[model samples]
Structures are given as structure tokens and as C-alpha cells.
Target: MFGDDWLWMAVQWSPPYGERAGFDTSTTVMLLVTALVKAAFLWLILRAPLPGPLDRRARALRRLLYLAVAYALVLWYPIGLLPDAVDTASQLALWAAIDVLYLLVIRWRSRVLRAAAAALFAVELAGVADQLLDDLNLRQVHWGEVVGLGWMVGGAAATVLTVVGQWRDGRWSRGTLVAGWASLGVYALVITLNLLAGHLFSGGPAVSVIMDAAGLVTTVWLAATARELPTENSVPDLPPARLRAIRVAVATVTVLPIIAMIHPEQAARLTYTGWSTDCYDRPSFGDLKPAQRDAVFLCVARGMDGGGPPMFPESMSDQAILAYGRALCRAKDRDEQEAILTRAGSARPSWGVNPWDLVYVCPEIIGATHPELLRSAEETQAANDAYIAEENAKCRDPWPRTKGVVQATAKYFLFVDGDPGYLVHDPGDQAAEEEADKLYSGDGLVTVGRNSALVGHIEDVSDLCLTVKAFRTAPPRRTAGWQQVEEVPIVSRTGRLTVPEMGEDEVGAGAPMPNLAIKGKGRYRLRVYVRIDDGGEEQHLVVVFPGASRKKLTLKP
Candidate 1:
């Protein structure tokens, strides 16, 4: 039904899958040949004359053939994974009820039985009507769907009403005959829809038209025989035993497909011989066997020409690409490594992502061997260093003045670092024990590492004007805030620092302010001068300069 999907499936065992854009010449030829065969069968069904005036037995046999055709065409929906199968239980109940009612009316010609069957048919028609309403609106109705729906409603109504009339009146009327002809309209409607909708057939136009022709033939037979009621001792038919056997055969045909549906994997295991050779043109490629997946990876790593989209393109899952990359990482040969990396680079479709970034799956190897390719990180660090050098060069012996003052709560802290974390004040605060172990100290200000320090304030300090000034040498310090000074040694990774406000809990809770840019990445001496006014306002000066070795030193107020 799914065109090149099934056609190409024949050769899907070939390496790589889902890469085909259109049908090849051979597939096209095969489709045409298949279409011709289907057309021939359709022609035979629709135009081939009946052998003679078919008796009741002959008509019944022909109707069985029609049933077989229907089972072949439709049973796939339920037997496969179509959502329509969810209604199986209710549909089977309806069918059983209608079938029993039909048999009862046939045997005893009960008016009640006829009415019940008519009611069941009406219920079926109601379902069709509901579907019709759901499918199209008044202003945007597509006649194709409507006609397709009519085909179903018309057929069921014709069959049931004809049987009901037979039970009640013992003869067919013009109305029942017209109803039978209307049932034939299903074939017309479906074919028309296919054309009207620009040949949007479920299994392509060829397959759909054949099915429609087959349906039309079935409707023609049923309509032609609707009035041919049997008399006593009509031409000898199959015995009871044979009739039972036929019913069993039909039931087996119906049930086997359902059994497959219930355990499709078992069916696939039994039927599927194996996959095709190494070529990626299959419908689905996700669940590949380990060996097959490895082979594909090896093929791509060897730089084998895929001739179309690269194997394991960027569109694939990172996990899949990573799996391949990890396998490539296992290769120790330098040439092989380069070949794999080159292939990985080409497969990356997105821009701004370094080719080396594609194999971040093996970051340790790539980072160690090809650090230069990690330019994004390097470029960012360089830019930050340049900005810091420029800003730090503005520092002088007399600190440059600042403009605006920021307000803060009485007891807040300034944490200076490229990346700062919350402070752990209490040694008993076990929840933050790990952070305290790595970074806490007893002093008001303590340098955690080469790059970070925590500076605390206990008194209420508002109007906090903050500024940073840097010098090539340690410039003489001048008192600023409360004549309290704390000096700490810090190392700069990218020559940049930030001071963020810490809350009363000693946790860094406010935004970092007044970033400090110094000379290039290296060890530096940092001095903080604090001045507090009697009216609860403060001013601070920070000075940074080159230094070799230093320790934390604090002067209290």
C-alpha cells in the first residue's frame, strides 16, 4: 500500500536505510507490471459475463467469493496496527446480533426478526452518519468523503432492507432494487474521490482502482441476484457437512490475521528471512541489530561514499552518533582517527558548531589531541582577557571616582569571583558542609582559591558606591570605608572578576555588580577599603595589581 516504501523494502537489506528520494526505474517497472495485473483482474470481475443464469447455490458461492475479496482488502486494518481495531469488540457484537437476526428471519420469516435487523442496520447507518458529520463541515464539505461514506451506508442498507423485505413481503420491490444499485455507487464514489483529490489513494491509484472495481463487481452480483429467491428443491447444493467446512475455512481466514496482530513479532520472526545487503533505503532504521549498526559505523568511518545524505547525519539522535563516535574513539590508529573525525565533521549540518564539537561524544580524546579545534571556548576567554586588560589600564595611584551608589541591607557580603557560590557561615549547618569544607573560613573575608573571596559586612551600610582600579604594581592604599581593609590573593583565569551581594544568611542572593577587569590571566593582589558613615551609608574601593605569593590579611574597624 505504501508505494516505494514496500518496493524498496525488498532491497532494504542493503546497507544504509531511508535515503531514497524517489523510485528507481526497476521499481517503477515493477509497479507498472503489478498495476497491469491488478487491472486485468478488475476487468475480469467487472466485464466477464456470467457462465449462465446462476442458481441459488451459484449465487451463494459467488457471494462467498465477494466476501473473500472484502476480507482480503479490509482485514488488514484490524489485523495491522490501525486505530480502527480498537472498536473490534463492539463491532463484533453488532455483527453477531445482526447475523443471528438475519438467520432467524431467513428460517421463520418473523416480522419481529425483520424489524430487529432493520434496527441494527439503522444503528450501523447512524454510526456512518456520525462519521460523515465529523469529517466535513457545511462550508467546506468534500464530496469525496461524503461519497465514500454513502458507499458504506448504501451497501449495508441495501443488503439488510432487501432481506427484511424478503421476510415480510416474500418478494423484492423497486425500492430494494434501487437500494442494491445505490450500493454499487460505492465503487463509483471511491474512484471519483481518487481523481478529485488528485489521486490521493491509500495504496496509490492503481491498487485503489482495482479494489474499487472488485467492489463494484461484488455489488453488481448482489444486486443482480437480489430478486432471485429460491423455490423448493432448487438445483442441488453442497451438503450440510460441506457447508460447515466452508464456514470453518472462512473463519480460519478471518482469525489467522487477527492472531498475527496479537503477536506481530512472532509473525515477523517466522516470516522474515533476514535483512537485505548493506544499503540504507528501508522505511525504518532505528532498531538495527548491533552487528548491522557496527558495520554501518565502520563504513562511514572508512569514508565510504554514501552517494547521497551522509550516513548518521546530524538529523540522527546524538546517542546514535555518540555510539558511533565512541566506537571510533576505540580506534588507536592516527590515520583511522583522522578519517573518522573528518567524516564526523562533514556529517554535522548545523553551523557555528565546530566539526570537533560533533564528536564531543569523545571529548577527552578530542580535547587532548585537538585543543585548537575547541576555538569557541578559547575565543570567549581571549575576548574577556582583552576587555579586562583595557579596563585595568585605567587604574591609577588615586582611585578613579564612581557615579551611582547602590543600596543594600545592613548585613550583606560581596563575593568576588568569575563564578561565585553561596557562603556557609555556621560550621554546624551540615546541609552546606560540603561547600564549607571547600570554601569556608573564620575571617570576615577569606580567599577560597586563586580566583575567589568572600567579604562580609555586619553593620548597616547603604549608599554603597563601588568601583575597581588596577595597577601594574601594588599601589599605596588609602582609607575609604570605615578605614577597614582586607587584602586577599586571587588568580585570574580570564582577568575578570565580579562582586555579588550576599544576604544576611551569608548566602549569595543578590546580583553581582561592578565587574573588575585587570591585566591578563595570572595571580593578582586584591585590596578592599571600606568606609561607613554614622548615618548608615558606605563607600568601598577595590584595587587589583600583579602579585606572586600572598595570603588573606584583614584589619578590623
Candidate 2:
């Protein structure tokens, strides 16, 4: 009976190491109190007067010993001894047995039984004391009360039994019994107070006062009601085999549950990965549906160099209007593009166009011809540029366009147009207004119109024009205003050039302007200056050149 099964149960019932109370002063005091209580109870039982029969007393002593052993088992194994279900059942059984045993002792009317019960009660008191200490030290009051309360109740019952046994045996006078009863009452009060303090303060030094009072009262009551010693005699003993069997049964019933609680579960040891395609770990365009995928692909394709291929085949039916829009842009078939975009806008009324789509590719078509449709796009770009300028100005830095040659380089990058009208206009006959609305409504077409003139110019020349502007910096000497200094220009001759005619009206005061009429196929440079009066300060110049490419010059005083 005492086998691996019992050991497993014990292992299961043992308290988890993580939950164990750390050793501390409060724990030590609890242990000390428990030891003192046990010693006092033992002294009382040993000194108690002999009852009518030695056998009755022996039986009582045996019962108390059993209870003491049970308390020890509980303390050693706490919760981990068995499976959760089994441990719960075992706990119920143990409590039931204690109650039944108490009832039997009361019915037997034996002083010896009472003494034995008291001894067992003392053991339970010790167990509870240790539990209380653990709770105080570990700050686990909830668990402590759960495990320790039972033991405290058992101890109180045992104390009362001892007092009754002494009184019935005629070992004490009536006055002494009354006093003992009164002492028991005081002990109960003290225990109640200890419980209250424990609940109120939880794990604190304040509880020690109550525990001390309870312990003192219990000790004094036990001492005052001490019984005379009974003579020792030989009694019938169980066979060795029977004794072994009983021991095995007791261990199996009591120790197995605690052992079972400590082992880790099998499920905790395994890990899972990539259970399904929707799982994040599995990877693939998991979030996009087929339509959304096609939408994104077609949108990106329409915005590619020269408005490239259709992202999806012509045969695909769902969201066909978007596919039609892509075909229009791809074919550079303006009538078809307009027709498709219009259809898309009608189908999806919530769609809004984006003007930035036309800002670069078809700026003239969208901005100049259909200004209302693309105004927001232009304003957005201008706002973005202003924000960047404001941030750069914070460091006392001049705008890059006002510096030497940088603006020309920047414009060269910005205005490089290989196939300008490629994405500007739809190839279909749909109205520009409808197409623009669809684009804005997120029908996937970038609605900004392309400049036919700009695209023609780029194609004709095959080269980009660079316009350079120059400005003078502030002088070292104190002055009211700045004056313009000499201007220098640098040219990048790599592409073809076709300078547009510039009118005199475009020139501003003291601005070194470009004379487009004198233009040649190769890059050229020109210098201009601003005149200042009284030499008040070094003048700063502003220059504007006609073309997509413009550079700036900074003149230091």
C-alpha cells in the first residue's frame, strides 16, 4: 500500500516552491509560540489525575496522536500532493474524520480520551502557528488563513476537551473548574482577537500581540487544569503485519496528494508554430483580399514609368472599372481613360481624386486647364514645401534655392520629363470632371493633369534647362539693409536644351534675368547685379530664369 502511488500523491500535494514563505523573525516567533503551546498541553496531560479506566485513557491518547500526525502531514505536504480533484476530496475526508473523532471522544466520557484529544489539539495549534508564520513572512495571508484556520479550531476544541476531562475526573475542585472554564473563555476571546488582528493587518508585526495573548491564555489554562499521571501497563498489540498494513494505509491516504501537485504538466512543455495560413508566422499577403490586391497592383502600375502595363488581365471581372482605368492610362488613350474613370466614379461615388498625381506628369493639363480639380494637390505640395522651408529656417539657414547652383540641380531632378503626357489625361471620352472626381475618390487613378507643352519641350530637346539665381549675403559692417554682389553661374551640359521665350514683364527690380532669345543648344551662363545707394549695406539679389531647371548663387560680401 505504501508504494510509488503514495509517493506520487505526496509529491503532488507538496506546496509549490514559489509559494513557500521566506524565513524571518515572524516565522520564528510563530514556531516558538507553537512549541510553547505544545509543551504546556503535554504537561497538563501528563499531570492529569487517573480516570476510571486506563484503557479509555490509552484510547484517547491514541486518538490525539493520530490527530497530531495528521496535522504534521498537512504542514509537510500543503497543496501539491495529488491531482486537484483528488486533493479536494482528501481534504474533505480529513476534516470529516476529525469531526467524527471529536464526537466519539465526547461520547466515550473518558478523561484519558480528553487528554489525548488535547495533545492532538496542541499539535494542530503548532501546525497553525507555523502556517501563520509562513503567511506573515511570505505575505500570503489568504493562503495562510485557508490552511491554518482549521488547525486553530481543532486546537480550541482540544483545549475545551482537556478542561472537561479534568473536571469530570474529580481531579480539580469546583472553584478550580469554574476558574478553568473562565480561563478557557478568555483563551477563546484571545484567539478571536488574534484572528481579527490577523485578518485586519494581514502579514504584519501587529498580529504578534494577539498571538502572544492567545498563547499565554492557553498555556495558563492548560497548566492550571493539569491532571495526575496514570500508571503505565502493557496492552494488547497488533501483529507486525497488521501494524505495517495500517501504516501503509495511513501514508497512502494522507501523504499521496501533496506529492502529486508539484510535477509540471505535459502541455506546458510543448510549443506551437504556424498553425494556419492566417497565422502571422505563416506569412503571405494575409490581410489583402483578391479585389484589394488587384486594386493596389493596378494603382501602382498606373503610376509607374510612362504608365506601364495593366496590373491584372482584361478578363478579370470584379472591380472591372478600376482595371478599365489602368488600361486607359496604359494606352495613353485619353478618351478611353476618361470614359473608364467616369464609369468608376459612378460605380463608387465615395471615391475622391488626388491632384498630386497630375502635379508632375500633367501639371499643365490638371493645374492650368482644370485648375479646380487639381488645386488641392498643388496646395498640398506647396504646403509641404513651406513646412520644410520653415524647419530649415530655424537654424538661420538660407533657403537652398537661394544658394549657388543647388536650385538648378534640384529643378533638373524635379522637371525631368521623358513621357510627360503619358499619365496626365485619360484615353477615353469620359468628361474630365467625372474622371477627376473618380481619381479623388480613390478610384486608384492619380488625377493630376500632365502638361502637354512641357512634355513636348522635353521630347523635342531631349535635354533639361537649368535656371540659376544669385543673391548677396549680409555684410560684416552694421547696415540698414543688404546689397547685391556679383553673380556667377555654372552649367551642366549633359542633355538637350530648348529654351522657352521669356517676356520682359517677368523680370523684377535688380533681378539678374535670363534672355531666352539669345539661347543656344549648349548650356550658357550670365551675370547681373543690383545697385545700392549710400553704400548703406551689402545688397542681396533675387534672380529668376525661365525653365523647369533653376540654380541659385550666394554672394558673400
Candidate 3:
């Protein structure tokens, strides 16, 4: 009778504003208030005074209905043991059964009352079978109530017919008259409130408050109407199994309230609020328009250089395009978008910027250009391979540059021989004496800042030259920046070494020996800076240290 469909929606729904979700103090208070109402109603029905003519079934049905309502709200006892699905189903089923019983009770005394109750029950059972399968979703069962309102009204008309029929039969009594009116009136009031709740108070605290008040009022009406029912003298026989089940149910519902209060989360584990009727749509991203460009990162290239044209030797500009490609693609205006692309280019050469993809490659700005550079993948690999081979040729032992030096790589190797370590060796693979071949190697340590600093030993002492192009202490350690001092020449016609040794060396058939030795040990930071002839004017920084630790630092490619 109560909380079957419409009222349950309002009762179970939370206020939209705040502190609605989860088990908390406010929700507990609300739940406890409703449960107390149920318990109070149950006590009133069970112990209230009654006249001595009502059937056993009628009295039992009232008590059963009260029990179902009380236990559903007071969830702490044994009824809490049932799964929420079963609990919900049982509530609906019990109420529907009560409606059927009420129809029976009023059917005899007043045909109008009996017909009205029966019609109400029929309206409830309309989509009940489908609803059970549909999991009690209100949308599925609500349509019947739409039609039921008319049936409910029609039953009211039957009330007049019923009163006339009863009075003519000479069986009219005041109790019967009151029961008839109460039955039809209560159903009509409830149906009307339910319709109003759906149409007017759909969401908010007011809806819940209104529904709760209606439930309380309905309970009060039932209590008043039950008073008009007179009790029978004899109790009907009951099956032992049924009696045991009833006792167990009563015990369970009684115990559940205590546990539910103590452990609310567990009791509510299988419960959920109904879905909202509101709907939300998604946001828009506008559109993407294509533009003309050779580089993959043209959009980002423009952004880096302050709206100017893209330069060469692309650095991290490509990475920028890759990161913001989506947003760039979404740009609508072509010239404005192209301006973004124009600024995307970089002048500083990064590791990934090499080998020539003409699609975006720029030789003049990227240092030096070569004919072998190609945009095709196949051509790039071939060019790199040929370049590697040409470089190895100009190594320690020079090879014929038949391939026009497509590429060249300069490498430094440390040479070792005597304990003095300045001793370089390698004969020209001939008998010594008439002219002994010498080895020249920069690999050995020369503690320059210290007293012992042998720049290097050269085979052709006359061709050897040492000119300090530029010198300064390394960056941060210098504080004020690289402090430039003086440019001093260390090697001349009289080389650093005079006495020479000879032997066959690995680099070539014969190499020069280092006879120049350091005077003593000191902190040395003398390093080599090379300018590759084939790779344009780009300089490579290679720092060599002065100890047996042999630490080498290659600062850039």
C-alpha cells in the first residue's frame, strides 16, 4: 500500500544540493525518523482497540501489512539479512497482497468499496509481471498508473452504487459505511498525491518531505479505518510450518534494527538510488582545415621564432609540431596557420636534423650542403654508408680518396711505449740507421699546467707547428666567463723532441716516436679542438686530460 512505486521514488531520492551520497549522520537521522514512524504505526495497529465482529483474516492482514512496512524502514533487524533485491521485491509483493485482502474485506459489506479496491489492485498488477523482470524500474510500471487513475475514479462512482445497493438490502451499518468511504477515499487521495509527486515535485528535498508526510497520513487513515472492523470470536487454524516462518520473520526483523544501526554500510551494501531523468550532452571541438607545407612540424616551427619564416638546422621544432599536431590541425585560417608553421624552423643543429630531407632540409643554414643529400630513405642510407667509408680512409693510415671523400670522420688514438710515456715508436718497416721512421701520437698524457708538459712529438720537426689560436678556462669554473689570457707558440724549427726511436706500428707500417717528455707532474687541462675539412667550418670539442685515468670528454658532435 505504501512505498510501492511513486512514494518509494521520492523517499529513496536524495536532495540535489549537498551531503546526500553515502552513509552519514544526516542520512542516518532521516532513516531513523522514517523507521520510528513505521515502528509507531506497527505498535498502534497491533495493540489498538477493535470491535468484536471482524474476520481473523482481516485482522491478520492489517498486522502483516504493518509488520512489512515497519521492518522495511527499520532495517537493523533480521529483515536486513535479506538481499536488497529480495527486500524490495518482498515489500511490493506484500503490499499488493494486502490490496487483494482489503478488496475481500470490503467486497461483502459494500459492493462499491469491494469494486474500488479490486480495480486499484488490478491497476497495480498491470505491468507487475514485466516489472519483476525489468527490475522495478519506475518507467516500466508507471504507465499503468496513468490508466489506473481513471479506473480509481470509476471505482468512486461505484461507491454511490454500492451505498444504494447495501441500504436497499437492509444490511447497511455505520462501520460498513465508514469502511467503504475510507477505502475509496484513501486510494483516491494516494493516487492523486502520487500523480502530483511525479508531475510537480520530481526532484528536491520538498519531494521527499511531501512523500514522507503522505505515507504518515495514509498510515493514520488506515489506523482509523481498521477501528471500524469488528473482530471474530474464534481464531483460524494455521499450519505449523507457516507459524514457524512467521515467528522466524518477526525475530529477524526485530534483531536487524540493532545491527543496521551499528553497521549501516553493510546493511546498505545492496541498495542504490534511482537514476535521474536529466540528461547531459557533450562539448564541441569545432573543425580542422588543411594547409600547404613541406615540413611535418610547420605549424610549431612558426611559433618558436616569433612569427617569422622557418630557418634551417631544425632543432626541437619538430618535437613541438609532433606534440601540438592536433591543435594545429584544428586551425581554421590558412595564412594565420601558415604563419605558425613559418616560425617553426630552428637554426641550431640537433641530433635528429641531418642527412637531408629536402622536404624541409636547408643546407646554407644547416652549416654545409652536399649533392649526395637526398629526401628519399634509400638515398640517405647509401649516402651515410659511403660517407663512413671515406672517413675511415683518412684515418691514421691515409687511403685513396677515389670516392671524392663523400664523408670523413676524424678520430684520436693514444699511443703508448716507454715508461716516460712521451716515447713514440714505429719504423718504416726497414733497417734502422740511414733514416729511422718516427711515431707521433697525442694519446699520451702531458701534464701541461704542471711542469711536465710535452705537447707532442712530431716526425717532421720542421713541418710541426703549435699556435695557440684561443685559450680560456672552461665555462662555469671561470665564473666571469672563459677568461682569455695569451696566445703562445710552443713548437718551432727546434721541435719539443730531438732524440727519436723507431718500430713498426699498428696505425701504419711506420709512425713517429715521441721523444719529447714532460718536465714534471701538474694539473693539466690542454685539450684538442678540431675543424673537420669535409664537414664545413663546424668545430668539434674534444677534451683530453693529463693522467693515467685517461678521461676523454667529447663535448659536441
lDDT, candidate 3, residue 503? Answer: 27
How close is every model to the real structure, measured as TM-score? 0.29, 0.21, 0.27
Per-residue C-alpha lDDT of model 3 across residues 135-197, encoded as one tens digit per residue: 645345454655655645655555544444433433334433433554455455466556554
State how far residue 25 of model 1 sits from its true place (Å). 5.1
lDDT of 2 by residue, 1-557 (tens): 45433322333333223333343554344444444444443444344443544456445544544444344334435554544544444444554454344444333366577567756655564564454445445443454665566766666666566567655555444433543555556556566555444223335332442343333333343333322223342223457787677457534432332232222332111111112222222122224343333333333323223444333233333335343433443434445555555554432222323333322233344455555433344564566456444532332212342454322211111223332211122222134324433433221111222210111111222222233342232222222233333323223232212222222322111112232212322233323232332522112222322233233333423
So what's the TM-score on candidate 1? 0.29
Q: Give candidate 3 regions above 4 Å deviation.
A: 1-47, 51-54, 69-85, 107-113, 136-204, 226-228, 231-557
Give model 3's clash tally.
31
Candidate 1 residue-wise lDDT, 1-557, digit = tens: 66665653332211224455776564365445444444443443344323446555545544544454444445544544644433444344444443444444343366665666556566554554444454443243345767666646655564655545544544333333443544455545555555534322222233332333335434443433332333332223457686677557534433332232232231221121123324343211233443344343433433325354444444443344545568566666656655665565644333222234233345456556765443444474576456444533432223444321221122223333332223312223243244445565544544454456544444443223444556667766555434688777766565455454444344332333443444666677777776655645454556667788677767544
Off by over 4 Å in 2: 1-61, 68-80, 83-166, 169-202, 205-557
| Rank list by lDDT | 1, 3, 2
